[model samples]
Target: MSDVDSELMAGLARMLAAGQQRRAARAQTALETLRSYERRILREAAVMGYVLGYQSGNLDGRTGIGGPLDKNNRIPPDSEILRRVIEHCDSTDDLYPFLAAACDRRRRSITKARRWPGEAGAR
Candidate 1:
């Protein structure tokens, strides 16, 4: 989640602690919605990463095609195209296993990144 999200959640927690029941409930709902959206985006990123044959631990791999190669830059074309195709694919049932593996890879990446400051923000 972003810094703004963290602030909002903290505010909500404070309001709940202060006994502002109705407002606290509303804020809690908003927090849940924000969390759901965050999860969806991370899932999307994982799908894109997997479709491009990106191994989680190998962030320095070459693409063989011409493009920017910066860790802080946007995802490459092949990944973006693959993600689009996956988005339009009708047979999601077949993609579940791949998505699950991608999610596992993302989780591991996140865990490792968290150990180093500022790496979490890049993911």
Candidate 2:
């Protein structure tokens, strides 16, 4: 090939490599964000579960009354809930709205229970 053509091909190759690297970096960032959201959602779900269980007297001093607990009698991670959420969601765009709404609802419920302890038993 001519020197000009060789140089042009080399430049194109470098551009392509740089573009791929940028794409990879963006993908890594997106993945990290998704994982962070998942962790936050799981943590919120766990806290909500604990609060509900405590109010309902399940965790007051009882064992084996209500649960999908492990042998150690601990509430397991909410992988099933996360899996179902992921299955129902078409994309991360959809996932965030749904998860955010769920977390908001749980937060409100916890707040209400705290403000009116008597009303908690009515639920």
Candidate 3:
């Protein structure tokens, strides 16, 4: 092939590669966003479940229907975020706001714990 033809082909190939790379990066970002939402939903559900189960256990114990509930007081601290969400966003499946708040609460707690003084696990 002529030099000009070869260079043109190479330029086209480079453009195609750049476009493919851009598309792939965008797809990856979308996937990550979806996965982040998924993770938030699961975390909120689990934390809510923990709180509910603790409450249920307490009721059962009070009624003498079962043993004491959450004797170790394992009720999650993050439960408050879920409760607030329920109070404010009642009757909706939209947990985006709740997820943001709940994750932030957890992140703050984690950051605090990491800086805890006189603790073996402290940084």
Return the top candidate by TM-score: 2
Between prediction 1 and prediction 2, which has the larger lDDT? 2
Q: Provide the lDDT at 68 for model 3.
A: 53
- Per-model TM-score, in order, reads 0.21, 0.31, 0.30
Question: What's model 3's TM-score?
Answer: 0.30
Model 2: per-residue Cα lDDT over 4-123, one tens digit each: 999999999999999666544443333344546555765576557665764566545554544434355554456544443333332342334433333223212235434344355664
Ranking by TM-score: 2, 3, 1
Every candidate's lDDT: 0.45, 0.49, 0.50
Q: What local lDDT score does residue 52 receive in model 1, on the 0 to 100 scale? A: 48
- Model 1: lDDT of residue 112: 56
Residue ranges of candidate 3 with Cα displaced over 4 Å: 35-123
